[model samples]
Target: MSTDSPTDGAGAAASVQRLFRNTVVAVSGALSRRDGRVSLSVSGLAYFLLYLAGLRHLGFGPSGYEVSVVSNPLVRAFRQVGPFQWEPIALVVVGPVELLVAPLNMLLGAVLAALVGLNLAVSIVAWRGPSACRLGPGAGAMSGLPGLLSGFACCGPTILLVVGIQASAGLLSLFQWLLPLTVVALLGTLLWVGSRVETAQQVA
Candidate 1:
């Protein structure tokens, strides 16, 4: 048996810590620039709005101005209606705009949006900066595609599967895993993008 198991484990822990630290540093540095901030804000906002629109929470409807809350807003907010979905506890309408206020969903959307925004921010900054290593902004930009796709996957699982192909238990289970998979994808891509960016000390 290898007597260096403790050393190996310690090394693994240190590696993970270094990876996270580097990722954070890269993201922070990227977001510090004006162009990076603009990219982050625009991409994040667009994603969040599309996310809500996909969920039928935000759209154009009858013209009106009103705000209504469910009887138990707090309790209703956390009530799950589907895989990783919570019930909306309020409705807001302003002229032609309508919105369903679901706290949990909004929170998730924010997180996903931020991840995507950070990915783009870092990628953009890296591409514009002079780096010692070869960098392709496309790689980092495309990484967020899965997260975007998965967000739409949560809108509604395809009910019609090639007319006759039935969804198996395994396939059905996969639908439920989409959101979690997206989160993992987003974080993984963020780390990947961050790893390629300028380090904290080299940041300008």
Candidate 2:
């Protein structure tokens, strides 16, 4: 017959408790590392709100436009396909350059939001430590600069519009595409960073 020692049982219980405590600490630390990303995203959102408010206060709003869809012979011939009705495409009527201000501002705001989301995701991976994933320190923070610059595009154009300066069609087109490009770039950066982290984690 065998009897368990009281001291051995107590030591086993203490070991389990210690392991639980360490796990909790590690989880909390990992979560806390995301604080910076959260703060930046909130700040970016606030800036968007302020910008929209300013635009409304300054008498800027959506311009009137109409779009129609019709089957075109040229399009059909180019595709070597039978007559087909094209999809309804809404085209903003090109009016006074100032009229483009509101749309441009909206685009920039969207870009900023996208950037913030990507930055937060990247930051989380980065904070997980090199063992979890390998992103150089601060990579997530630096990724936000393009989004910030895109936001500035809206401010600068709005200022020019308010000052009665007209922007050329070419310039307006550039602004039109800038937001989408910025969003894509931010997404690409996020993917790149995430892949690096994933790869490192796998290797480790």
Candidate 3:
């Protein structure tokens, strides 16, 4: 048996460096080198985190559910805008435009408006590194945690079953509503899977 040479260790080190460099370049394109990756990765992460955080502003949450059947704010807004007025100006051009969208529009304006507002709010706020860097990233990560668990095999139908049970009761506790919510999550998963399958088939 022969002992390893110093040249062999040097070659190994160089190979690792090259591999790391290539990986960074692939995710981040030309900008992945040095400090650029830090900035881009942080910002992208912030944007995604904020987007999920904004969903909290929706009427539903862990504490209690809003029992009202009224349209969500965004849906109301969309109705006011109408098909003809869907241009860029609708976001902040006029406050009174919301009034028009609320009652007159045929579609779900309030729900649409609320979603847009939530996403925009999250994007703007999360970009500032909101609070200290540590806290901000932590918060963002927590907000996104639900999306990760969604991949569990039982998560989909489990939710649907829970939701059905809650609906049967005619009144639901906070945790009880989770079933229906789970079902909705499952439906979203199915849709995503369907899309992927369709795309794959098309490619084939």
Candidate 4:
């Protein structure tokens, strides 16, 4: 009574494997597209360079000279936040630039953390459906914009304060909150986009 060919089962398995492979390729290709990759790389590299500069300024690099507390607007803002603990690690005079290593490190860390969140969001969206795979990279990049804006604004306020402009404590607090909000927004955007794409695919 049962006359199903063995090859039928093997063929079905092979077909599924092909589909999975193709989906992976499509998602990776979309993320690695020229524009998307450039945007991500530029942001990542900029953050890394800034972090390196901060390290150098703190006398922890090849061009380092001394350990001194560099007072700046950003440093003041960080002090208000109380998230970073700044301490004098002995002095060995080298230059005359005000460099707040703790705050700079925090800024770089936020960028890296944001980037990781965005990547996860993209991966989720890309794996959801074919349409989502097409939309994931661009949407992920757009979502990351808020984080970048927050990072820039964090430093911007301090710069203005350094220039003798009155920067409000409330404004600095708002920037501090923006980083977490950006991560939440990115996750939401990816979920929403993925749902819409899945729905559209179903309807089609």
Give the top-scoring candidate (lDDT). Answer: 1
lDDT of 1 by residue, 42-102 (tens): 9778778877775667889999999999998998899998777789999999999999999
| Residue-wise C-alpha lDDT for candidate 3, range 46-138, written one tens digit per residue | 433332222211122244322333445555444422222221212211222211112222122233223222222222222333221112233
Per-residue lDDT of candidate 2, residues 1-204 (tens digit): 989999999999986665444333322333355554464566457556544443432233356453333356334323311111122222334432122123444555656654554444334534545333333455434534543444454455444545566789676456545545555655555444443332233446
Better of 1 and 3 by lDDT: 1
Evaluate candidate 4 by giving its C-alpha RMSD to the native, one decimal.
Answer: 11.8
Q: After aligning candidate 2 to the native by TM-score, how far in Å is the CA of 130 from where it should be? A: 6.3
- Listed per model in order, the count of residue pairs whose N, CA or C atoms clash below 3 Å is 0, 0, 23, 0
Screening candidate 1 with a backbone cut-off below 3 angstroms (N, C-alpha, C), the clashing residue pairs are none
lDDT of 3 at 152: 30
Writing each residue's lDDT as its tens digit, candidate 4 over 90-135 gives 3454454434445544564556544543444344334433344554
What lDDT would candidate 4 get against the real structure? 0.46
Candidate 3: list runs displaced more than 4 Å.
30-204
Clash number for candidate 3: 23
Provide the TM-score for each candidate, comma-separated: 0.76, 0.39, 0.21, 0.41
Q: Best-fitting candidate, measured by TM-score?
A: 1
TM-score of predicted model 2?
A: 0.39
In candidate 4, which residue pairs clash? Answer: none
